[model samples]
Target: MYRYTEFDKSFVKSRAAQFRDQLERWQDGRLSEDAFRPLRLQNGWYVQRHAPMLRVAVPYGELSSAQLRVLARIARDYDDPDPDVYRVASAAQGKLGTERLPTHCAHFTTRTNVQFNWIPLEKSADVMDLLATVDMHGIQTSGNCIRNISCDERAGVAPDEVADPRPFAEIMRQWTTLHPEFAFLPRKFKIAITGASEDRAATAWHDVGLQLVRNETGELGFRVSAGGGMGRTPVIATLMREFLPWQHIMNYIEAIVRVYNRYGRRDNKYKARIKILVKAEGQRYIDDVDEEFRQIVEHDGAPHLITPAELERVRASFVPPALHASHASHASVDEAEANANGHPLFARWLQRNVAQHKDPALRIVTLSFKRLLQSPGDATADQLDIVADLADRFSAGEARVTHTQNVVLPWVRASELLALWQAAREAGFASANVQLLTDMIACPGGDFCALANARSLPVAQAITERYQDLDELDDIGEIDLHISGCINSCGHHHSGHIGVLGVDKDGREWYQITLGGSDGSATSGAPQPGKVIGPSFSAAEVPDAIEAILTTYRDAREHDERFIDTVRRVGLTPFKTSANAVRVNEEVSA
Candidate 1:
């Protein structure tokens, strides 16, 4: 994990204090809502459907136990909504036929940021103060700015890693944090970097995607892509540079974003994403960025080029933590294997939740946040604290928040896997469904987000409840089932093997289902949006529709083929027919 330096500590404290001042001014009427909106947004505070929501950045998904403890504290103390606000919000949800909305919980997003809803705007300053103490903040997490820089959760520890991307991601993070020139772009921008052979970070779905690569001569560089995004337009980023020297990454990215800032659409929010610009311009857009890069290097002297010493300094912070000399040795792998063979449930958990680590002695364990009862990605304050404790005890006092909206104990000793699994099971998150159908990605739809056309939680819950049998989930195999509240694609519905998108029809909630989407992982071929099966279906029909689709998949799939593979092989027609067959409302199609 990257530890904060004195300078880093000071800078975050200063920013937090700055936000407190702005908040006080807004509260005292010195700044009107119109004037204060941008300021608060820059600090990652947003007025959502019911109360203020705070998005706290966890850069590259890395967190120390202390930082996790602070987040837990925020969820516990400051996340309580005002009484009247809660009453109104609860009543609104009741009308939607949802169970009572959960509060005092933090949501782990697909981008690896932690979000807290129901926090009063007035207490935002207090929350900021608390975050600052742990060298955390929500800076640049919102508004039309360079949002958080995400990286692969297994950056340094993945067996297939070419080079760790964290140092470069950190370098970019520092450069983009408060860059005055690029602060207010036409739309929000996101960047994802991965150094591993497997595309674990979904780089191709970001505004700027970086893959660490080496040339034929073995010189380190990057494969750079730009314009990928999801929303009204789902685009796989265009490959801009096949091999950009690693040292020049920042300079090259500066040019790319500069080009976007110059010509990206500003009049219409729907078309403001760089993807729209890139799609419209194509070769011309690439040419513009090339020209900009030339000017930046020749005329402006490439001021952002990363130096070797600076790279080393940044890399030093990311070095794997050493095992303490006094720590007791854990059980051997042979013993764990023996235990697993005896306990079928333990074997199931191991198969789904544990991943290979670069170090054979260690393992990467994902704590399943997707289960029945709770909305996906949500962890109560108590749950958060339990995760923190687990991280400290099993993962060298560190953890990583995965892009799949789960927590990774990236340093768990292989021998201690059984004990850790048991602890997590007792904590209620060890469901052994890491990539199964029940381990779905879903947003807090109409339940929390004001932008939602329908509720996502109910749909997710219904499906989870329908598939409680472990044997059934394993039979379905690994799949990406993503649900988004609206076209915002917060839950990344566009990339799911089976995508359920909430839609508005008059005043009622309907869902548009898509099939054969991929997030560009080794298993999921390439980054591409799913195809819409047909007209939207009513919310009541979504679960049955899904059941029908799965049934169709089971019928059509080749031996041992995954759901996504089967969808690709036979195409969406069969699944589409199956899903639509269950739809009772013909009016939805009309």
Candidate 2:
């Protein structure tokens, strides 16, 4: 984990204080809501459907135990909505045929940020104060500025990693934070970086995707792609640069964003993403960027070109933490395997929730937040504290938020696997279904988000309840089932094997199912959007339709084939036929 220097600490505290003053003026009627909206958004505060939501940037998904504890404290102390506000929100949600919304909880977003949906605007300053104490804030988390830079959760520890991307991600964070040049662009821009061979970070689906690669001379550089995004129109980014020297990444990205800032659309927010511009301009856009780069270097002297010394300064902060000396005396690999074999539940957890690490003695263990009744990616105040404690005890005082909306103890020792599993199981976070169907990704839908056309929680809950059997889930195998309440794609539904998108139809909630989406992982192949099977189904029929599709795959899949592979090989016809049958049956029953 990157430690915040005194300068970084002071910068965050000053920003928080500045936001406090802005909030005070807004509260006293000196500033209009229209005027204060941008001010609040720049600080990571948003007036959502029923409450003021706060999104705290967890840069590159890294979190210290102390930071996690502060987050837990915020959830416990400041996330409660006013009684009247809760009552009205609950009533409105009930009318939509969904359960009352949960408060005093933090949701781990697909972008690896932390969100609180029910915090009051009055306490915003105090919350900011608390976040600053931990060197965390909502800066650039909600505005149309450069949002938080995300990276592979396993960046430093993955076995196949070529280089640790955190150093570069940190450098980008420093360069982009409050960048006056790119702030308030045509739309919110996202960037993802991964150093691993497997595309664990889903870089291809980002506004700017960067893969750390080596050129012919084995010199470190970046494979840059731009324009990928998901919304009303999903697009895979076009390859802009095959190999850009690592030192010039900041300079290159500046040219890319600068071109977009100058030429990207602004009139319609719907069509303002860089993906739209890239799609419309195609090769012309690349040519423009190349020309811009040339001008920036030759004319502007490439001021942002990173120096080797500056790179080393940032990289120094990411030095791997020393493992406990006791690890040398811990149980051997054979003994750990024997222990896992003895406990079937532990064995299952080790297989599903744990991943290989660069160090054989260390394992990356996922603490599953997806469980019965609880919303996926949501952690209660108590659960957050438990995770903090677990991280301190098992993972060298650090944990990471994964892109799939789960928590990862990246430094967990192999010997502590059983103990950590026991503690997590006691805390309702040891489901051992990391990428299973039950482990779905969902956003705060109409129940909480004002932009949602339908509720995603109900559909997620329904599917979770339907697939509660661990044996059945394991048998079904790894499947990405992502649900989004709207076309915004907050839940990354466009990349799921079975994607469910909520839609509005005649003032009622409906769902559109898609098949064969991938996030460009080693397992999921290339990054691409799923295809809709047919017309939308009522929210009530979504679960049954999903079941029908999964059943189709199980019946026809070849031996040991994953759901995605099976979908690819057999095509969407069988799944589509079964899902459509469910829709017809529901209509007839109704």
Candidate 3:
């Protein structure tokens, strides 16, 4: 992770003081709610249904164990002493453990950040002050500003990685942090970078998605896509440049954003994202962006090209960890191997949660927070402490938050896998359901969010509980079910293989399902956005509808084929027919 310098420290401290004063003014009635809304938003404070939600940016989803502990401490000191509603929800689901719960928890987000749902409005400044002590703050998390820059969680150590993307992501983070020009664009903007052969970061769905590529001549560059996003008018971003030289990345992004700022509609907030401008303008938009980029670099002196020394200074911070030679066996592995023969549970967990690391000796393990009877992305403060402990013991004292709402221990040794898995199990973080139906992606729906129409957490909880059978989950393998409470798409419902978007109908919650969506693969190119299956279903009808859809897929799929592949082979007609019979789970429950 990149450390903040003096300038960065000064900026956060200054902002916290400014916001603290502003908060006092708002509380004292010197500032109206209308006047104070933007100020609060700029500091990542949002008035929610029950309390304020504060989004804290975890840069590139990277966190040192110490920083994670700092977050846990903030929950302990600044958050409410007890949250009764969450307690009841957890108790019903058998998750109200003996460990003390924090007033609020750090909810891992789709952008690889964390959010707190129940922070009191009066204590928002104290939260910022705590975050500042650890060089963490919530700037750009809300409001019409460039949000956090995301990169692949397995950027450096993945087997198929083209390059380590963290350095470049850090560069962009520094450059865009407080850029005067981009702070007040037509709407909020997001950027993502992918460095591996697999598109785990869903690059094509961001305002600017950059895939690192090597040209025919073997020079490193980027395949840039612009204007891609999700909402009512979901649009896949278009390829803005086939091979943008790596040096001109900052300049090229500036050019595109400039075009968007100039032409994007501000008349209607609903139609304000860059996607609308790109769609409305089409080829003209692309042409204008290209022209602006050309003039900024060629016609104007190369003002934006970063010097080699400066680039090296940024890149040096992300040096790969020093790893020992492979070809060694430990008693830990011997013990695990001995247990593997009899312990089917550990074996199943290893098979599902572990992935091949670039170094043969190492393994990248995913620690699932999407446990049965719990919300998909919710984590207890106690779990946070346990994760930090595990990272210190198994990994190099580091962990990453994934876009799919899970945590990654990116550098575990193959020899230590079993020991780590056992620790995760004891701490209630191991689920052996990565990329499975039980591992759903969801938002903090109507329960906490002011923008939600339905309760996404309960829906996720119901689905996870219904599919608690490991055999059933394994049979229905590699399915991505994403749920969002509203059109904000915080759960990234647009990119799932099975997408669920919650809507309000006659003041009751209903869900609209979309099928055949993929975030796309670097191996396969740009992704396929989800297509609507049919009309919406009531909240109670969703689980059964899902079961029906799964049954249809099982009936039609070829041997060992994935759900996405099955959907592609047979379209949505079969799915629609089966899903319409939303009585399978209901009959079983009855």
Candidate 4:
């Protein structure tokens, strides 16, 4: 993990002092909510339904054990101590308690490069102190700003990767942290880089996705995808540069950001995402802008001087941990455990969720979020603490967060699988359903998100509940059911084997389904919306619709066929008919 240098520490301290002063002004009524909104947002604070929520960016989902311990402390000190009490408590009480004290909901997510929580407005100073100690700070995490630049957590270590993208990611982070050049963009922009053969970073969903690849000539390069985003208008991004050499990647990205910053729509906030810009200007126009920017950088001979020495300096900061030669051979224990435990569930999880490591004997264990009957990508504060502890115990002194919103203990031994599973079960993190149908991704919809047109979580919950039976879920095999509140596709509905998008029709919520979309290494595309299914169902009917679709697929699928392959071969008409059939059957039964 990259420790903050003296310069980095100084920068954060300065920003914290600035924010503290801003808070004081707001307290004295010298600054109105309107005046403070942008300032607070820049620090990743949002006033949510229950209380103020702070989203701390954890750059590329990599965090030291010490940083995670601080997060646990934040959860225990600021958020509710009891998970049950916290979940059901009244908003007024929660807010009152949080307001009276410096409480916050400590959350670790795959987005951004920092961890954030909802702390009391008054405690900004204290929070700043805690951040300073860690040499971490919230500088450009929010606002209509260039948010944290994300890169693959396994950037330097992945054997199949072209090069460590962390150096590039770090350079971009430093350059864009608070750069005045493109600060006041039309809307928030996101940038991500991946050094893995697999699209673990989901670069396709970012405003700018860079895939680090080696060209045919064995020269380091990048495959750039531009205008890709998740928002009201979802576009899976188109390839802008087939092969941009490593040296020119940053320049090209600067050019794209500049183009969007200057011409992207500002009047309608809904249309401000880069996806819309790509659509309005066309790919050719965006390409021209990128070319023009590249020309300027090349002509000036500015970006060219970032030599091997500078690259080495940045690389040294992100080098992989030193492992001992003695830390080898957990395969025997893993095999023995599997033999004793007749549960194929555990075996399947081990096979799919674990990754091979650089060390011959060690393995990278992924704590998969795809679990039967669990809300995809959601973990309570308690669960967060538990995972943090496990990371310390098993995965050296650091952990990795996946773009899929799951945690990865990237240095666990294979022998510790059973023990780790036991601990996870105690913490409610064990649900042996990685990649199954029940591990659906869903947005926080009307229940929490103000941007939602319909409630997405409840619908997702309904589907999970319907398929709650572990045996049934296992039988169904791997299927992705992703739902988004609106076209923004925040939940990545467009990339699921079964995609459910929520929309408003005549002031009532309705769902549009799509099939065969995927966000895997081989396939990178958005799922096209299928036939409209009429007015959205009540919370109870949501499950019924999903069940019908699944049943239809189950009946029609060939042996060993996955949901996506089945959908592609048979089309959505049968699923549509089945959904209507289920609706009619339920009405008659009722």
Candidate 5:
């Protein structure tokens, strides 16, 4: 893990003090909520359902064992002390031990946002101290400012990658942190980098998605996609630069951000994301503007922000770990094969959840959170603590959170598979359903989110319950059912095998279904929604609609076809007819 330098520590300390002063002024009534809002947001504080929630940024979802320990300590000291507050109490107790009590702290990782949130605000200083110890500060994790620069979690480890993207991500992080020139944007701007063969970073859904690749001449370069985003109107990013040299990545990004800062919409917050700009003024104009800015910056070095040496310094912090050749042995392979059938329940898990590693004997173990009858993305604080401990014990003292909202123990030895699985089972994270239909992605709708038109979690639960048979799910093959509350697309419904979007129709909750959407490298287009379905039904009808769709797909699909492929071939008419058609017919008595 990268350690914070003296300069980094000073920056965080100064920012913390600034926030403390802001808090004092607000408490003294010198500043109102409207006045203090931006200051608090700059520090990662937000007003949530129950109380003020503070989001502590964990850059790129990478955490050292020391940082994890600090998190455990902070949870014990600051948040609510009840172990039973969340469902995974045993897991929490196992990780932090019985002596530690739960603080009100709850930890979560967003696909693109690296954040930690909790209620109450008394322990801000302690949290800042922990953060400063590492090379991290939550300077612009939130607010109407440029947010954290995200990259693929498996940047260096993935076998089919162009290069490690962490260095570039780190450089961008430093350059954008409290930058004066691009600090105040029309809306929050997000950037993602991916060096993986697969699009694990959700690159197509970001403001800037840089795909690392080699050009025709075998020189390292990037295929840049711009203005891609999710919200009311979802647009897959357009190709701005087909092939940009490696040396010009930062310079090019600076140019794009500069152009957006100058011409992006400022009149309406809803219309402010770069996607709208790209839509209103075609990609050609944006490209021309970007080229113009690039020339200007290259000539004058306008900001003089990051130099090649500075970037290399950041890159040096992310070198790959040394693995012993002897560790990759046939014995480890035999051990994995021995445990293959130890538990039939884990057969599918071992097959789908685990990722291939560079070392033949080692595998990147994925802790499956997609279990039956549980909230898709919800993990109790205790569950988090246990996973942290397991990472320390089995993996290489670190863990990576995936864009699919799951945790990955990137360096787990095959010999330790059974032990890790048992520990995970105790923690309630041993779901054994990673890519199955039960592994649904859903957003917190009317339950916790204020922006929802209808409830989504319950709908997800109903779908999971309907398809509880593991054998049936395996036979059905890979199907992604992503649900969103509204047009904001928080659950990434626009990219699901069977996308379901909740809508309000005449003051009643209804669902709009879409097919053929996918987010991986294999599939690269947004799925179109089918006809609007029935009035919001009791929980029972939700499952019925899903079953009808699945049955229709099964009947209509070609041999061994995936759901998205089938949808693409046959279209949504059959599924729509299945869902809306009457099952029982009236008897015609003569």
Candidate 6:
């Protein structure tokens, strides 16, 4: 975990003070809502249906126990306590008191950020202050700026890692913090990086994606890609550079974003993403960016270079915790294995949430926020404390958030696996549904966010309830089902194998389905963007429609094929036909 130094602390305190002044100006009518909109967005404040939503960035999904406890404190203090907010059951799903409302819950986002929904607009500064105390902030988390830099959750401890990407990710985070030149680009931008063989960060769907690669001579560099994003026109970014020297990454990235900022569309916001620029301009865009990089680095001597000392300082902050090395077998581990064998439920949890660690005696334990009966990415204030305690007990007093909206304890000992599982289960977090259909991703839809066309949380719950049978889920293995209340793609429906997008049809909520999409890791190719299946379904029909698609795949799939593989092999005709039938039958019944 990274601690704040004097300079870092000063920067956050100054920024928080600045935002507080901005909020006061708006309240005093010195600044109109229109004038303050962009400023507020830059600081991660959005006026939602019930109240303002603040997205606090958790860089690369990393957090220490102390920082998480601070977040729990914020949740307890900052959330609105209005009586009307509790009237809506979805928003108040975890109501705790005579009680409680949906007021203080925090959502862990798929982008590795935490969102405080229902926070009062007046208290945005308080939220900022809490985050600043823990070396966190919402700066550049929203708006048209480059959002948080995401990387593999298993960055340092993965055996397959060529080199940890955290140091470079932190370097980029600092450079792009508030770069005046690119802050108000055509539209929002995102970046994902990985040094691992597995694409856990979903690199292909970001505006800019980078992979750390080692050359034949064993020198490390980057393979840069541009134009990737998800929305109305989803695209997997094109590979722009085969290999860029490690020292040149700073300037090289500046050059690519500069090229996109120059030529990206401004007429229609729909066509404003860099993905559109990459798709429209094709190879010429890549050529122009390369030429710019050459001029900046070779001709002008790279004025934007990060000095070695600065790089080393940031790099040193990300060192992994010291741990006892892994072992083949140990007393605690052997006892745990025996206990797991006897307890079938614990065994199931081990098979699902646990993975092999780089340290042979250690294990990777993923805690699911998308449990069978809860909101996809939400955790109550108390739940946050539970997470903090679990991290302290088993994972070196630190935890990492995953892009899948789950928490990762990357350094838990295998010897303590059963004990950890039992503790997590007692806390209602041992869901045993990692990367399965039950582990669906969703956004805060019409229930909380004013931007949504329909409610997303209920659909996720319906699917989880409909598919609670582990045996059946195993039969239909490896399904990426993403549901978004709107086409903003916050739920990443465009990249899901079974994509569900919500639409407003004649003032009623309807869902559009898409099949054959993936986050690019399921298959041995660039991710396939989703395509519309047929007519939309009403809210009531969504669960059955999903069930029909799964059933069709089960019947039509070849031996040993995953759901994604089946969809790829058979195209959308069979699933489409069955799903449309379900849709029609429901419409007639209505």
**CA lDDT, every model vs. true structure:** 0.90, 0.90, 0.84, 0.69, 0.70, 0.84
Q: Per-prediction RMSD in angstroms?
A: 2.3, 1.5, 3.8, 4.2, 5.8, 3.0
Per-residue alpha-carbon lDDT of candidate 3 for residues 552-572, written as tens digits (9 for 90 to 100): 999999999889888988999
Over 12-74, each residue of candidate 5 has an lDDT whose tens digit, in order, gives: 878777777777788789989899888888878776532455566766767776666666565
Q: What's the CA RMSD of model 2 in angstroms?
A: 1.5
Candidate number with greatest TM-score: 2
TM-scores, all candidates, are 0.97, 0.98, 0.93, 0.88, 0.88, 0.94
Worst 10 residues of 5 by lDDT: 581-590
Question: Residue 443 lDDT in model 5?
Answer: 71
Candidate 6 contains a number of clashing pairs equal to 2
Candidate 6 on 386-448: residue-level lDDT in tens? 999999999998898887788999889888888898899899889888888888889887777
* Local error of candidate 4 at residue 534 (angstroms): 5.0
Model 5, residue 400: displacement in angstroms? 1.1
Model 1, residue 547: C-alpha shift (Å): 0.4
Residue pairs of candidate 6 with colliding backbone atoms: 97-100, 326-361
Off by over 4 Å in 5: 72-109, 112-118, 121-137, 302-308, 322-326, 523-540, 582-590
Candidate 4 residues lying further than 4 Å off, grouped into runs, are 80-118, 157-159, 324-345, 369-375, 504-511, 520-535, 586-590
lDDT of 1 by residue, 402-503 (tens): 988899998888888889988999999789998899989999888778899888988999999999998998898899999999999998999999999999
Worst 10 residues of 1 by lDDT: 324-333
**Candidate 4 per-residue lDDT over residues 1-590, each given as its tens digit:** 67788888887888888888999999999999999988988877776543555666676667777776666666666654333333554242221222222133343344634333345667766676676677666666777778877777566656677777888887777777777866788888888899888776778877888888888889888899877775556577778888887777667777787788878888999888878878777966566776777676877665633567877887887765665233656665567366537867666666656666665556677676554444456555556667778988877777877666667787766666767767776776667666677666776554445566676766776676567677787788888777888776767777777778877776667677766677654333342333344444545666777788888888999997877778888877888787777667768889
Q: Which stretches of candidate 1 lie over 4 Å from their true place?
A: 82-94, 324-331, 584-590
How far residue 171's Cα lies from its native spot in candidate 5, in Å, is: 0.7
